[model samples]
Target: MTSRVRLGSLIAMLAVAASGCSTELPGSAIAAEPSATPAISDARSGEVFGDLKACDLLEPTTTPKGFAAPEIERYESDNGCAAQKRGYASVSIYLVPEAGIDQLSPGQGTKIPTKVGGREAVEIPGDSGTEACTVAIAVTPNARMTASTSLNEGTNEEACALARELAVAAEPKLPRVG
Candidate 1:
């Protein structure tokens, strides 16, 4: 075989093997698959909240005075939960892994960089400013604690401020796991 042809064949073989194209490699013992079950795509969510519900993130002790107690609801469709303070604001949390921290843009409302529980975050103003807000906290490199709120009881600024407070309360609650 020509040296060029031999080199081409080797390269192709390597590429196929790298991509798991062949189940077994000649003269080489294939490593055994991991005995442990593979992690779920959204496993980070469970890991961060472990045994804790979304409503648990609402800490009345940590909640400010202006905002009333939250009315929490859980949805089965997407394993999501939300808590709302009637007429004042409503905050909801979900697990967005590796979600970007910077959300400043036109027509996305006013986005301000801030901190929650001393962690980096961005406050995205909600529609009807008086009734909604969403705070995205960078809890971990792979997990983003998104706290969105709706304000019905106060001005846009009030709701955004409330959202920040709620995010602060929930930040510490999340597991600091990577």
Candidate 2:
């Protein structure tokens, strides 16, 4: 009789425990409903430069004073170009389709908020022992164009000025961003 009572008690406890367990499969959904958040894609960002090469934005004949005619070179893979003046300075331009001015990485430099042709821009002065600066101009909320200048015998300020000038000249050719 004692053994029977123990077995009954054990079965009752197991029954109570099983009442709180769930029988749903791993991938089974609790409800058939759509998600609240929508999926994101490139089209949702805004307009982007479609086949607009960076090299076509600037003219090789129109360069800053004291610099030779820019030797334009287009990037093989990415949408970028370099207009280099041998032994003096080189201005490289890039079009980032999925990035903004805020997303730019100011590597080893002081970031200064500025403007390029009335558009929001950020200028990064080169760090110590370097003679280069970069200016990134906002094209859209998800896109940007950047101009980086490297001067062989110029100060950081000069480099930044050159970079800003290059960005200003190229901003008009880029797609207007609202």
Candidate 3:
């Protein structure tokens, strides 16, 4: 199981590095160095991309720090349209367990897009026993994603909403030469 987790982490890291951009990891902004972590060899499960390029997902063991702040486990996939000059698809799913975090969507008078970066954003309410929250942001574009989180961890709807915001944040990371 530990090996599986490490392998998942490595794939997730590669996907992010390939994009040439830095993203936050679940629980903290600090990253685990590749040279320090051992590699895992195993047959992977779950299907993400069909025709498009799909990378591994990052699973976090801790909670995040701020609003609409990017969770660390998301991965970006390039569409392979070398000449299109478009950016890679960014995806991240994080749990926001704060009481009001789940309700952190744009203000009542605010406007939000259902889909950003070609990936639709969704929020599912949840509870971690200690708090009432939501399972926010199961993002995927150029791929499919399914997230089933535990109820004991609480939810952060605000953070989930932020995941979408973070995914779109990749817009500036695209290559200027592309």
**Candidate 1, residues 1-178: lDDT per residue as tens digits?**
6999999999999998899766666796779878555443444445544566565676463255544544455532133456545544456666554334543231346667777777887777754344567777775555566666675666667767766776777787776653
Clashing pairs in 1: 87-152, 87-153, 129-156, 130-151, 131-150, 131-151, 131-152, 132-150, 132-151, 133-149
Count the clashes in each prediction.
10, 0, 13
Candidate 1: list runs displaced more than 4 Å: 1-45, 59-79, 97-107, 127-130
lDDT of each: 0.61, 0.75, 0.32
Tens-place lDDT digits, model 3, residues 127-163: 3322222222322222223222222232445434433
Span of 10 residues, lowest total lDDT, candidate 3: 80-89
- State which candidate, 2 or 3, has the greater lDDT: 2
lDDT of 2: 0.75
Candidate ranking under lDDT, highest first, comes to 2, 1, 3
Candidate achieving higher lDDT, 1 or 3 = 1
What is candidate 3's CA lDDT for residue 140?
Answer: 25
Q: Name model 3 segments beyond 4 Å from true.
A: 1-113, 127-143, 146-155, 170-178
| Best-matching candidate per lDDT | 2
TM-score each candidate.
0.56, 0.65, 0.23
